[model samples]
Target: MEIKIDDLTGKEIIELIGEHLQGMSLNSPPESIHALDLDNLKKTEITFWSVWEEGQLAGCGALKELNKKHGELKSMRTSSNHLRKGVARKLLHHIIEEAKQRGYLTISLETGSMEAFMPARKLYESFEFRYCKPFADYQEDPNSVFMEKELSHFYME
Candidate 1:
């Protein structure tokens, strides 16, 4: 799989993001959904990437700079065709490495609290993220679960 910075104007990236939003909306109420739409992903502080395999879009993810020492994971979604094939894992590992390289001491994320999000929680746990109080303007919402991973000594070479 090839992962690279995404130009959101591209059809593939737009479609993939659309699908992600649609899926999230189907699984949760619109009020509880916090996944960034394409416009939000275009912010200056956010860096987004799209993964491709054999010329087909496989998945996408983004890292949003919360501050000099912190980052937030955003827009992580693997295409239905790419599920269980490690696309999300690869994109996640790539973003984690990028965060370390950028000298971020912590990477935090907010994902759905519903059963539909259990797999995502498991994936974050596998990368050593632990549940935490909401960070960076987030509040305690029953529909949201917050997680953070400390990278104080994690160096990427």
Candidate 2:
């Protein structure tokens, strides 16, 4: 798989992001959904990436700069066809490496609290991302679980 900085202009990427939003809508309440739409991902503060394999769009994720030393992971979604194929894991490690390369002291994310999100929670835990209170503009919500990983001493595999 080849991961590259996405310009968000292609039809495949647009559809992938649309599918991500649609999935979030189906799984989470309206007020609880935080998946970034195309407009949001297009913002300068966010660096979006797309994972492609053999010319097929495998997945996508983004890193949003919260501050000079902090980042918020966003838009982490693997195509349904790519599920359980290590796409998310590879993309996650890529994001972590990008954070460390960018000098981010910490990286954080917010995910669903439902059973459907258990796998995601486990993935973060495996990366040593600890549970934390909401950060940045997020407020506490029963529907959400916040996680943060300090990159100051994070070891990349």
Candidate 3:
């Protein structure tokens, strides 16, 4: 899979993000949805990426600079056709590497707490992310589960 910085203007990616938002709406209440829309994702602090395989969009994710030492993960979604194909994994690894390169000491994320999000939670867990209290501007919410991973600059994977 080839991962590259995305400008959020492509038809395929727009549709994929739309599908992601639609899925979130199906599983979570409106107030509990923290996923950003295209406009928000385009903000200066957010770096968005899209994964393509054989010229087809496979997945996408973003890293948001919260501060000099901190970053946040956002909009991680694998296309339905690319599920279980390691798309999300590859994209996640890329994001983490980028965060480390940017001198971020820790990366945090917020995901759904529902049963439908079990797979997502597991994926983060596999990467050594630990469940934690809300971080950044996030607040404690029953519908949201927060996780964080400390990035050791000297640690080689």
Candidate 4:
């Protein structure tokens, strides 16, 4: 699969992101949901990506620069048919590489605390992300699990 820096303009990506938001809604309450919408994904601080294979959207993810040395991961999702195909892993490695190249010191993300998010939590853990307190504008919420990984190790390796 090929990962492209997405402009969030294509119909397929819009539908994919819509599906992601819908899934988040099912797994978490509205107030606890932090997934960004299409418009929010278009903001200057966020860099979005779409993974494709044979011209079909496989998955997508994004990085939101919180500061020169910090960032937040957002909107990671794999197409239903593409689950277990390493789409999320490829997208995640790509985002982490870009973050390292951009000089980010750390990257953080928030996902659901429920069982629906277990796979996601495992994925992050495999990448060495550890639980952390709420960052940025986030506050303490039992429904949310926050995680962070420092990028210096990538550079070290």
Clash count, one per candidate: 0, 0, 0, 0
TM agreement with the true structure for every prediction: 0.96, 0.96, 0.97, 0.96
Residue 105 lDDT in candidate 1: 94
Query: Which residue pairs in candidate 3 collide?
Result: none
Candidate 4 TM-score over all chains jointly:
0.96
Instruction: Tell me the whole-model lDDT of each prediction, alpha carbons only.
Output: 0.94, 0.95, 0.96, 0.95
- The model with the greater lDDT, 1 or 3, is 3
**Ranking of candidates on lDDT, top first:** 3, 2, 4, 1
Candidate 2 vs. true structure, TM-score: 0.96
lDDT per residue for candidate 4 within 21-102, as digits (tens), equals 9999999999999999999999999999999988899999999999999999999999998999999998999999899889
Q: What shift in Å separates residue 47 of candidate 1 from its native position after superposition?
A: 0.2
Task: Give the candidates in order of TM-score, highest first.
Answer: 3, 4, 1, 2
Segments of candidate 4 deviating more than 4 angstroms: 153-157
Off by over 4 Å in 2: 153-157
lDDT of 3 by residue, 82-147 (tens): 999999989999999999999999999999999999999999999999999999889999999999
Worst 10 residues of 1 by lDDT: 147-156
Native-to-model Cα distance after best TM-score fit, residue 66 in candidate 3, in Å = 0.4
CA lDDT of 141 in candidate 3? 97
